[model samples]
Each structure stands twice: as C-alpha cells, then as structure tokens.
Target: MNTSASHDPNCIFCKIIAGQIPSKKVCEDEQVYAFHDINPWAPVHFMLVPKAHISSMAQLGQEHAALMGHIMTLAPRLALEQGCNPYPDGGFRVVVNTGAEGGQEVQHLHVHVMGGPRPWAKG
Candidate 1:
C-alpha cells in the first residue's frame, strides 16, 4: 500500500481497509484489498478495492494508471486462489460499475471479481 494512502472517513471500503469494519479478506497488498462480497452473485464472488478512495470510475484519471493496473493484474490471481479454474477450463469476470446507472451501490470504486458456475435466469 502507498505510505500515504488516501481514505474517506465515510467510505465503507475505507473502513474495511482501516480495520474498522471486518471483512472476509482474500487478498491484501500495498495498493489494494480484496474480500468476499457480502452478497455473492456467483460461487466465487469477491471485491477488489483500492486503498485510496476514488469516488467512482468516472473519476479515474491517468494518475490512477498504476493503481488500476495493479488491481487488474491482481484480480485473476486472487480469483484463481479463491477457486476459479484456469484459462480454457474456466475463467472469471471482472466488473466495474461506475455510477448508479451502472449498478454501483457503493460510492467508492470497486471491482467485482466473480467466477465459477453462475446462475442463469430462466428462459
């Protein structure tokens, strides 16, 4: 994590990162934190959040390149570690919801890493 990681006092993800809120943490490093989603959409559903508080994807800028890159690179590794299979056999989906219209409930930026056999709607 950056020595001067930015945080928002009201951000739930920030509290999780600060250890104020407990989470089923799956991965943690210098720049990001990964944990199981409270309400999973798949057999393997986890969230990857940046320690620094970026309101939403709409706010991302070139300055956030490294952090974004780190999150992307870390996702597959954690997904596999959390039970998603490898390439041809199985894979995972990474989703970033920017705003309300995008299905982002939380104001903080987070990437949802989901995999395994997903449930499909009845046709």
Candidate 2:
C-alpha cells in the first residue's frame, strides 16, 4: 500500500506487508501488519511489523514513539486473539532483536509476540 521510500524492496517483512510474500496474517492496518511466524517458538507466536521499513530498534527515534506504543499496546490484544490466555498467569513475551548480536535474522524492524503454554523448544 505504501510504496514509498520508507519501504525496502528487498526486505522480507516489507514484502509481506506489500503482499509480495505470503503470510498467515493475524491482523493488518494502515500502520502495521501482524502475522503468524513461519517458525514459531511458542504455541502463539506472531510478529507485529510496521509497514514502514525501519531496519532495527537502534534506528528508532522520537518520531516512532507513537508507532512503538501502538505496537506495544496492540500486542496483548493480538496475543489474546491469537490464543494466548488472559493475564497474570496468562502472559506473553515481546521481543525486539536489535542487531546481529541480538539475534535478529531479518533487517526489518518487528516485534515478536510469544505466549501460550511454555516449555517451548526454542525462541
């Protein structure tokens, strides 16, 4: 939808946002795209990705505050909708891998929302 300079043509997440790649979508809006992870580490594992192609968390600025907030706030709701339980005992993990050392495989900025029964093999 947003074919602007903010989008990276080569980025996988961008491709998914642009419908260039197939994804098990959870939800989508003008600012964000949420989808099930191909290799989930938990029973309910999905990602919240901004449509704009920011490379990583290190690149975030004041301009992205609202977007980040929206993502964070949306996580729990989406997590619950995706089968994560309520709260207290039922919770989720929000992960943002910053760079290579941080274990980020994709260059595009995204938030990983993992929840549901644990004892997951990996994350």
**Which has the greatest lDDT?**
2
Tens-digit lDDT track of model 2 for 1-123: 222347888899989998999999999988999999998999999999999888888888888899999999999999999999899988889999988999999998889999999787474
Give the clashing residue pairs of candidate 1, or none.
1-30
The lowest-lDDT stretch of 10 consecutive residues in candidate 2 is 1-10
Model 2 misplacement above 4 A: 1-5, 121-123
Please state the error at residue 104 of candidate 2 in Å: 0.7
Q: Residue 72 error for model 2, in Å?
A: 0.3
Q: After superposition, how far is residue 74 of candidate 2 from its true place, in Å?
A: 0.4
- Candidate 2: lDDT of 74? 96
lDDT at residue 33 of model 2 (Cα atoms): 97
Per model, state how many residue pairs clash: 1, 0
Q: Can you write out model 1's per-residue Cα lDDT over 1-123, one digit (the tens) per residue?
A: 222238889889999999999999998988889999998888899999998888888888778899899999999899899998898778988999877888899888999998886562111
- lDDT for model 1, please: 0.86
Which residue pairs collide, candidate 2? none
